[model samples]
Target: MKLFKLNKTNLNEVEQIPFKLEKDIQSLVEVNVESVFNLKFIQSELSVDKYRIDTLCFDEENNSFVIIEYKKGKSYSVIDQGYTYLQLLLNNKSDFLLVLSQYFNKVLRMEDVDWSQSRIIFVSPSFNSYQKDSVNFKGLPFELWEIKRYSNDTVVLNEHRSNSKESIETLNPTSNSTISQVSKEVKVVDEDFHLSKTNQPLVDKWNELKEEISNLDDVEITPKNDYISLMLNGKTLCYLIFRKNSISLEMNRGNVKPDGSRSKNYFDLDDPKKISKEGSWEWKSGTKGTIYKIPINKTTDLEYLMFLIKQKYKNLSN
Candidate 1:
């Protein structure tokens, strides 16, 4: 550095002076995590009862959360801090969970969602190869940014990211597994149901619903010969088996009435009335509101869907 003026006699001292290391590395990571991911960071102090954290980010879209910590010194056994944040997060889940579903968008529930699968990233300029190689990072979504001051007024930032371990069950693009075979002994539900094919409004409706619900999980627009089912939040809210223009409207909050009659009961939109929970949706003003208004098989509910899916996973997992 220009600050260190020395002759050849002291040249070795320059290398031993300890590089100052770029300081803006942490800020850059914060910028990307916030502006890119749309996360909010709340500043805090090590309060009387609880320790303080440097930064936290909420992924509202995925109902996933992320905690970030900066290490100015060496990596310590305190690495367990990230895990603690996750447990503390689940403890105060309500504050962050509800913020996920856009109340600004709509009052969808996020209680069924688990936020730990979010992520944790550590930023340090000097994460030695030893430290990086020694950490067992399995099953954790994380990243490391090693920043260095290269030349005059220039900095080098390297981002090493780990793939998210989060997995999902798509329509077994490679398996012969029938739903029946998957949930063989799992108290199967919707066994007699028909899958809805193309032109089914449920397909479109489910697509629209995805944007409205936050922290929504395992959403699959399941279609068979004549039925369409949306699997979300460990629950199959309802299913449709018809090709109706009823859902032409984008936003409809009340229940579409039965008897081909129109009433604002709101119960008409959901069935297996026990699972006929309250969920509101909105489309465009000029679109048709003719969404599918039929009940699913009585047995197919939230808990049951998880049972079936988990069961299916076991076979595939093995």
Candidate 2:
């Protein structure tokens, strides 16, 4: 992609700055990990058994660990490497937790982490056609990001999206038992999973909201391990979490005050907003997070949910 600087009279083309080395790419990502991907950087050059991971990060959104690898120029199988790192985390969960505990100066317990959400992210200046094609499966827990730097001291990170309905489990029969089992454990959430997790009526209601959100231009539906995220322009606007009793939503907008009083349908915290506050999953909400609990026991609650969704959409689109 080409970037240009616009002045009053003309547009000046910005030159692409090539990465001097893989370390350069890794350093750029490490410094801006939180801003770019909302991942907390744990440590670089993390070695697990025989394989050395380029960067180890924590995903506070799903309460899982993410393994990021940077490739400058190499041909490798994204599927094999992705599953292998997931297998490593699944087999040795304690070690990964220890790294997180040590980095943040706190004790992390095994129960606090969600092992199923473990993922491997591959970052490079570019990828081969085969490398891109290998991760076309919708359920795979791998992310491919293309990073580039410009002469104007700007950087761009674009995530490669896949809409294929294929499942990686199709290849499990011929693969090792660990890969097969891990593949089953670390798959992304889908509509089928949502239907099974909630009743048909609730699923239909959520789908209604999804349809409205999907109608927006440049919007994408990303199924995460715990919630269904609605993203626009590569930024998550909000996410929907299905519970046994009600459907919970966390919006990504800030400066939203407490909406009246707390009710069964809606609730917003009254705490003062602070940028230093931690553990918020939304990219733009900062520390002041807003959550709405829409009761699924009644179908009429869908209208209220839609109102909230539209309000959030309007706030974020600006």
TM-scores for the candidates: 0.38, 0.78
CA-lDDT, candidates in order: 0.43, 0.74
TM-score of 2: 0.78
- Summed over model 2, clashes come to 0
TM-score of predicted model 1?
0.38
Q: Which ten residues in a row have the lowest lDDT in candidate 1?
A: 182-191
Candidate 1 residue-wise lDDT, 1-318, digit = tens: 223325765632222122443234446556666653356653322121275656666655444566676776774632355445555565565665555444345564555453434555676666776556534333334456665544344444565543333221232344434322222211211212331333344545444443443234445554322344455433344455443333211112333333344434222332333433344433454322343332323233434333333332332233
Q: Candidate 2, residue 183: CA error in Å?
A: 1.8
Candidate 2 lDDT by residue in tens digits, 12-130? 99999999999999998999899888899999999988889999999887888889999988677888888888988888888888888998899989889887778889999999888
lDDT of 1: 0.43
Best by lDDT: 2
